[model samples]
Target: MTQLTVFGTLTTLSPFHMAHAGVSAEIDQNGRVRKLGTGTAKLPCTPTYKVPFPLSGDLAVGFDGTVRAIAEVPCLPGTSIRGKLRRVIAKRIKRHFIATGQLLSREAYHCIQCGAFSGDGIKANLTTSAEVIAADQQLFTGIFGGGPRLFRSNLRTHDSYLYCAETEATDVLPVIPETTALIRAYQATFAHPFIRRDDLLDFLDPIAPDVIENYAEAFESWQNTVLVTQERKALDRNAALEARAAKKRGEVVEKPEASAPTEKQKKVMLKGQSALEAVMPGVNFGFRIDIRGDDAQCGLVLAGIVDMIKEENFGGKCASGYGRMAAHLRVMNERQEEFPFLDYDGRKLLVGNQIKSYDDALESGLSQLTSASFEAIYNPKTEPSPRKGKKTDDHDDDEG
Candidate 1:
């Protein structure tokens, strides 16, 4: 069980949002949906973390005469956290080469780190003549997995739940009554609702005069057809009702022919308004990461985590001032002995037990990462030529 575990609390410095691709609807007494709201992935995935409802069966009603249930709790999913870390690491590596003026070929770069962090597909037409390329491939695959040889990742991440005083520190989120109580308490606070405005139509300064005129004409056409469209809809509804009545009376009913949609119906208008849900600031999520590698491997993962933390953004909607979190990480051995991995005092990244400065640690980490093999593969003086061969017509070359 020789593993290095990094455990910490990530406090939200700004509103955090992780989109869950589903809708939550407000139910009425008759079980009919009154309204629908897009949900965020902040909800807990397991029943162990779900809030307990009282036996009284009393429920809260909304202003629109709809009943809403607050049975689930919110949490920061580890998959999203892992995805964000991987992206930052890949970006950091790319920026490092660009800053050093290496200017490696796109194919060569892809060959070096294909299927490492993001996907599990081998890039086509890569010629591995040099051992340096293979070594670099191993380095990346060993850390993140799924390179040419498909090495398993040495690091594992666990789902993170809201930090509660009663919960103990563990790699996997504990399934206990206290955890349920924590979920219950967190459900009480819930997510804050905010209206995201569509300002694209409001600002037209950059639009060309001709383009604006075209838009005006289109809008005018839509306006003129509005009354006609309403009348058509009403007529269609009446026809449908008559057809239903005729069927009920045992009379044969001929279905109407399908008509093509008109241009007015296809015209883009103002986007629909949606109330977005987001986790508020000042809430802390407990997270844990286990590394089954030596100091070098651990250091590399820590470097990426530190780089991502420096950006101070996670999950989604970061550009709109959401998902900013401040991390407080500490590394410990399997025996529970503290191992000085890295430290971030909200500004600088200090590494090792001695806590070296950010620059020094970065230099050391980069040196270990870029050894003789790496230099041989990415010689700055020699520009890598693009792979020569017939390009495949496969459009499935997505770098997932």
Candidate 2:
């Protein structure tokens, strides 16, 4: 939406180069030459200005005959836009002149920073173009709502430029559902147009439609699995608690009651028990595995056990540490599909009771353990060896 203009000798520079300078000027207005000042002793002589222009008004013409004036031009958004413009100019120059062996002046071939092009000329140009392209790809992809890292990477390297450019060139393209929703939401909230529909459709079409659909479906499926799993776990836990309470009740009965527990008596007993019982014991009481502690005391003790199993190589024929832990924990508690707590030190700490996978168990265990506990467990008693003095084979052998 921003704009700037550059005035320079057309004979001396390419139109693309002029365009690049114009874009830069728009972004950085300070680059424009404002006034004709008196030349100092070190660089003596220009005191002139006010010359007749071919069209409209008088132009500020220096003693050297170079005219300076503001030219009207449109610019891309932000610094990245300037960089891309530079890259486009550089690429065009390289392809038309440099690669074909056309002779160019030192001024024409000079690097802007060093004023020379003696080393890695082609490589430098390519690298600059690549970097700029990468940045532009990232910006455009973000504008589109979503994109893959690989696709973005390829776009930057010119590998996917044709595909992206073609999409950009199209009209009335299909859009992703998420992107469409986002556009609608944005329009509703802002009460103004921010992203053009054409741009949205262009970006969306390049990204495979099926990939987006599948990703959405997969995410929903995972959410459903988690919800169902949690429900089933709650039901099983409630049944287990009820069974334990019933057994305790049976043991407490020393003799058959003179009268069986009537409905009123059962209601009274249940109310008394409810008053004493704590709701959500899991939330009220929990343990942590301190991974950084001695014996590797962890937030979840199950993870700690898994760590032990792995270190000892003790879980039958299974080579994977995770697999071994899952197997061993399953044997200990048939109801548990995996260890709920990760091993910490020699014991397993409770992380969660319904973790269904080893990965989840490990994560839950680590989270429960506090940083202070970790420091107490794993913090070295001795000071670390100085970097300069470290030279022993034993030092090299240490994993830390």
Clashes of each: 0, 33
lDDT of 2 by residue, 243-329 (tens): 545566675433322323345333322222111000110010011111121111111223323333334222121232211111112
Query: For each candidate, what TM-score against the reference?
Result: 0.57, 0.14
Candidate 2 has an lDDT of 0.25
For candidate 2, what is the TM-score?
0.14
lDDT against the true structure, per candidate, is 0.52, 0.25
Error of 2 at 378 (Å): 53
Q: Report the number of the highest-lDDT candidate.
A: 1
| Candidate 1 residue lDDT tens string, 37-139 | 1222121111112222222122334334555453233467777677777777777666766676556555345534444322433342243545433543444
**C-alpha RMSD by candidate, in order:** 11.2, 37.7
